[model samples]
Each structure stands twice: as structure tokens, then as C-alpha cells.
Target: MDKNTIEILFSERKKVGLNLFEIMKEQGYTKISFSNRVKISRPTLNHLFEGEISSITTFEKYLDRIRDVLQVQEQEFLIGRRTAIGELQVAFSCNEPKGYHPGEREKEMFEILEDLINLCDFYY
Candidate 1:
């Protein structure tokens, strides 16, 4: 992805904050409740919802918890067309990279997100 595409993806991700917050609200998750459910500290959850760009690992775990609690499909948590390859490249370039771990839970969650993205690609 080029610089312009990266810039556009970052802009789109910022725009997604409101929609993601709405989804949490729709699921009836108070900040405290969401923190407890997701096993993250309240302050951390606050940072995430307040548009702080957290580690991909942290975000992935949160997304997993949100999907599990809401009983929603993986696509429901995705940012859709806003997910440009540039944004993915940025995420992939995180300074503190996490190697793939095929623990059962991790594998399952990865597969779920992968499948959702693949399905979404059909419409792209």
C-alpha cells in the first residue's frame, strides 16, 4: 500500500470510532461491564473506546470478547470497506510484533476473522 492509501485508511479508522461505540451501546455494555467481560482493565477499555490506537493483540482480544458476548458474527465487528490493505500493513508493522501461536482459542479466533474477511472479499 502506498502513502496515500495508508493515509486514507487511517482517516477511515478514525471515522469508525462512533460506529464501534454504538455497537457496544447496542449490546448494552456499560464501560465497567465491558471491561469485566473482556478481562481488560476499565482504564484500558476507556482508552480503546476513546480512540487510542492500541496493540493489535489487545484489539484482537477485545474484538473476540465483543463477538462472543454479543453472539454476533465476526463480520459484525469488522470495519468493512474501511479495511484497506494499507491499514492492515500498518497493523502488521507494529513494533512489538506477536508471533502466531496456534493455541486452540487463538487459532479459532484467527480462523473466524480470516473467514469473515474472505467472505467480505467476495463482495469487494
Candidate 2:
């Protein structure tokens, strides 16, 4: 492939990685849980999502397993429809009511935030 074509291919692969990560989250899968489900190490899952994978075979294995678990069509996964967020830095400051106890929403928020931060760290 020409230089431009190679760049486009890499860009699409990065999109696929991001989309797969989102699909996992939407389906209520954590890195550990999803890695276990896919029979991949947590680090491997992390690399795959970060688009830092070096081996095509390894990438295909993860993609195949994820595609099966997500029940998404191959085309949809490979050519992900969701636009990849270029770069995002989100900050949130919240205080609960004085007498209020945290609930499921708060717990979920914390978990999601942790995951998002971990994901962001991969790009740096």
C-alpha cells in the first residue's frame, strides 16, 4: 500500500479499537471481566483497545472474540460507525448532599470514570 493508504488503514484500525472498547462498556463489561470472557489477558485487552497491538493474528483473535460476544456484524466492527473522539479531557467535581448516601449511580460513575482514565493514559 502507498503511504496514504497505509495511514488510512491504520486510522480505521484505531477506530475499530475504540469502537470495540465502547461496545464492551455499553454491554456492562469491565476490563477484567471482558478479558476473561474473551480469553485474553487484561494487558492484551488494554493493548488492543489502545491500538498498540503489533501482531495481526493477535488483533484478529481479539476482534473475532469480541465480535462474537457483542453479536455485531464484521463490517460494523471493522469499519466502525462511531466517530472516534480525537482527544478528550473530562473533569467532574461533585458533592453529595450532607446526609445522602451514595447509590448505584454514584458507584457506576466511579467505575466508569476509572475506566475512562485508564483508557486515556494509554494515549500518552
Candidate 3:
């Protein structure tokens, strides 16, 4: 997930909101019917379509339901940036050059931090 990919995902989500009403019209799905199908309240669906609330969980649930109904593959949802700052902090704290050789706990922490760093690089 580079910056360009993240931007594209955000753009798609915005487009989805705009197109949702059109899709509902094309599918002959009333507001109530779409709400029931997505297991969300009518007001919540309206807010989502209006872009009033940005709830990731709600959006994901709605999208999953819509994907199933439309026979489309589930789209990847982007939540936030991956900085790995916490992992970097932990990794720096794990440095015990004067203390001891790599023990089990140290090794585990190092491995976890390394993986986090790798993922951050891959996704950032």
C-alpha cells in the first residue's frame, strides 16, 4: 500500500458513496430493502450514503453484504497508515549489546519488530 494505492482506495470509497444510490435504483432496492439486506438501519445507511459518518466497521459490513448480493469480489478497505513507530520503539529498547546474548524473549521481540518493520515498509 504505497501512497498512490492509498489515494486510489480513498477515491474509490468516495465514488462508492456517490454510486450507491444509483446502484440501489438499478437494483430496484428500496431504502428499507437495502437496509435490511445490509443489516443496517435505514438512517445509518443514509448517513453512509451521505458521507456523514466514517465508520470502518460499519462500512466493511455494508460492503461485504453488498459484495455478496452483487456477486462481486470484496474490495480491500484501507483504514490508516502503517508507520511502525511502536515497533521501532520496542526494537530500540530491545538493544542489550552490553547485557546478554539473544535469549528466547529477546529473539521473539526482535523477530516481531522485524516483521512489523517489513510490513510497514511494504505498506507505507
- Candidate 3 residues lying further than 4 Å off, grouped into runs, are 1-12, 73-124
Candidates' C-alpha lDDT:
0.55, 0.71, 0.59
lDDT per residue (tens digit) for residues 9-112 in model 1: 33444444444555666667766666677787766665565557545555555655666776765434335333333233211222334785457886677677
True lDDT of residue 50, candidate 2: 77
Q: For residues 5-91, could you state the per-residue lDDT of candidate 2 as single tens digits?
A: 434435567777787777777678887888888888888887778788776655666676877888876556455545466545677
Task: Determine which window of 10 residues in candidate 1 has minimal summed lDDT.
Answer: 85-94
Per-residue lDDT, model 2, residue 36, is 82
Candidate 1 residue 3 C-alpha distance from true site, Å? 20
Candidate 2 vs 3: which has more TM-score: 2
TM-score of 2: 0.56
How far does residue 11 in candidate 3 sit from its true spot (Å)?
A: 5.2
TM-score, per-candidate, Cα-based: 0.44, 0.56, 0.46
Q: Which of candidates 1 and 3 reaches a greater TM-score?
A: 3
Q: Pick the candidate with the highest TM-score.
A: 2
> How are the candidates ranked when ordered by lDDT, highest leading?
2, 3, 1
